[model samples]
Target: MNREPKAKSQEPQTSGRSDTGRSERAKRAEGLPFASERLTFLEHLTVERGLSRHTVEAYGRDLEYFAEHCHERGLALPPQIDEDCVVAFGPYLASKRGLQPVSIARALAAARTFLKFLAGEGVLPADPSALVSRPKLWRRLPDVLSQEDAATLCEAPEAEAQAGGRLSWRDRAILELFYASGLRVSELCDLKLADLDFQMGIVRVTGKGSKTRVVPVGRDALETLRRYVALLRPKFAGPKDEDRLFLSRTGRPLDRIAVWALVKRHGRVAGIPGDYSPHTLRHSFATHLLEGGANLRAVQEMLGHANISTTELYTHVDAKRLLAVHAQFHPRG
Candidate 1:
């Protein structure tokens, strides 16, 4: 795992950018440099854990960033990534890399996962990252469109269709389903035809970590999807592309970037202010449900969140709105 710590005089000075103006000191005396081990760990994540390509890539990027930081300090990745090094990594990402709290926390999470994997495989005596506590996140609430704005945005595609634009049914269904199901962009793009149960108004969605959940679809979304499949999907889907639920004009499954652009385009047309992505619809869906008195656990299950704490963040949003209303209408104020 890691080499024994040597005297400060014996440590070599390394040239690299560091968060602090002072040169970074190596936390550990010696350790194995990341090489084949990093690759094998990532491979295990993909093959054994069933993580999606996007998640695998994000983990790889975070690990690489950490590795570079270690190299600059004349240290190596775990078991060299000791408690002190792991502790400093959060601040380094913030001060040096200018990453926000959420991004820094995510990077640390990646490092922790990697260290745990190495420890599990007997590559290290113990997990160094385990001794490091996670950084506190700011918990910035997601931006949500108002109900009127959401409805207007969802209808933009159909309005275009009424003006004789092709692919309107597909776009409208995409918007409606996003609001109805709260599926992640990747999950929506990867949805297969068989994933939808229109008769039952439910869709089987595979979310982060490849966890699958069945979410109910509203009648509006299901009706739009039914029309799209019957009318537009067949026109776009080629012989080889019939399995996917959503297709491009070229018959390939719609990619995440396309969905992003479509959301932004329609948001502008509907005069919704500020940036909005597919996830905005998801935030709106969850917030509106909570505002309407839906149970917290129900929303968690619908969003396929692994932890209830993650879903609890929406409660904060409701609290903030209540404060605003109280301030505006209270007679004493």
Candidate 2:
């Protein structure tokens, strides 16, 4: 879902001409190209643009690298950056700087956004970044677990199914929900008791930017969740009235890192090699549905994709199965 950017608060002002004098001196010592302006833009992205903290830090780091590039070449400020300067920096990032294509592309996007912001603020006459092409990037498909591997991973937590294990029901529910719903780690973590409707087999997931979508939970997942709520969750509840559906051993909401570790540990038990995380379950969920002939648009809605194009990636993953069907039935084959 698209959201309007939030506005950032202006920098605080100090009383007296003495403070003003200090500001001027500081700006002079920092040179005409003050890094503070870049920081102001970042603040605007956070408050006005309503960008996530992760995005803000990434953009800041990208711009800082660009600023360092200008410093080495004796450029005064971002306003002085022309199209040729940007074009030169691209090669510098690739060849001299030895950054990968994806990294360079991200850095270029950051530079372009900064330039656009400068133009919008009337700091620059035109955005020099507009003249340059963004670096071409190869899309890497997400690693998906095979159907057997997915089942194995889900079953790994069942070893704790024996009585006296801590929160085994909750862990099992978490695994089942991830495979059944295709939720991002953050979306899963954000789930609350009120968001679930066991009778209706639906889960209300708040996705990126607080956008809410209701996703259907499979019978198995619903059953697991019911078991968790009924038997295990009370054991983990704290004095505070937290309504989170899933809790850690500490009775607090589970963070993404902990979720990652859990998935990784289960992957080892399942005998699946290489890196695997919560997102792999999501990918496996989507890919499995597509392979089973689920409609793309329907899956898109369930996955809470703002654009259908993002959901098309699963089509690519299921293409091999499509080819097999064609070979089996097509007269030409």
Candidate 3:
């Protein structure tokens, strides 16, 4: 087990005034009814619902931004706010505040949730936020490697395998499983030794919201995993008999950040450009399946999307590729 030491910081400290100012604003904003209600909701999400701090903060920020927008519009406090007020706030955010479509949509979603909470608590007569429509924008397709590029990336572990003379099989297995199963980085890191069923060719994954699903492993991925388990993993296992499928050099479970760095390193080796990460492989997995004529429902199931709408992003990717092909070969000038 070889644990890398934390790298020392080299950059000089910037001004702290901006940080102090934001803190002050956050404190003052917490006093408002909107903010107070948000704090309560956040507390519920954390303590009762057991959501991660990252998710709580994201929801907090979204609600806080909407509350600030309402304040700017001179709308009466939470009790006085109505659907029309929220509807107007959308244009206000877009036209006057110059928020992007994604930002507006997030804010709207937050507001809807908060308003529903208020309605449930009998604080408001109705859920006004529900009336606010999310802004519609052309879906921005995810970046994915072509099949050749994906193959190149999967092969990148060979170099590391040869140089390190250890964990090469493990690295190859990780890369292969990622592209083959379309597992989210978190899901991949969470994998356990017991999750793989070699005979059945299935890997059980616990996805977002802690939902469990079984994904079939391709032949290449299964072979890679077999070799890794037989040749490399034993060398890295510690006395604890930890079940984690992927491990750090130090014989601990690999964390998400480490997985992200590994993906970037392999992308560089594969000549992939412009901020590629582990999710890029997941995106590639989905897009490549659609391009290969897989049905949307099947892709949705494999990707573990709770909603068909969530899976529809690949449709946009598929359309763009079709447009490219038509332009390249069509006779129309």
Candidate 3 on 1-333: residue-level lDDT in tens?
331121112111222554687698788668554766788888878787776555676788777677777777675467888778778766766886788988878777777878898898888888876655677877677998889988888888787666554655777788899899999988998899999999999999987656799998999999999999987788778999879999765578877766777777677876776877788889999999999999999989999998999889988988888999999999981
Using TM-score as the measure, which candidate wins? 1
Between candidates 1 and 3, name the one with more favorable lDDT: 1
Candidate 1 local accuracy as lDDT?
Answer: 0.82
Higher-lDDT candidate among 1 and 2?
A: 1
Worst 10-residue stretch by lDDT in candidate 2?
3-12
Write model 2 residue lDDT over 1-333, tens digit each, in one string.
221111001111123454587577545434535477787898998888776565676787677677767776788866678888888777878876799888998898888888898998988899988868777777667788889988888878777565345555777788899999999988888789999998899999987655689999999899989988988898778999679988865577876666777788667867898788999999999999988889999999999898998899888878866787899999985
Clashing pairs in 2: 5-48, 5-49, 6-47, 6-48, 6-50, 7-47, 7-48
Models sorted by TM-score, best on top: 1, 2, 3
Q: Give the clashing pairs for model 3.
A: 2-249
TM-score of each: 0.85, 0.78, 0.76
The C-alpha stretches of model 2 lying farther than 4 A from their native spots are 1-35, 71-76, 88-100, 322-333
Tens-place lDDT per residue, model 1, 1-333, is 122232122222322233232223232211325856777888998999999988986887787678867877788545666778888888889888999888888998998888888899988899887867676767899988888898998899876677566767888899999998888899999999999997888999988888899999999899999999999888888877668898877687777767787788778877889988999999989998999999999999999988999899888988888998999999974
Estimate the TM-score for candidate 2: 0.78
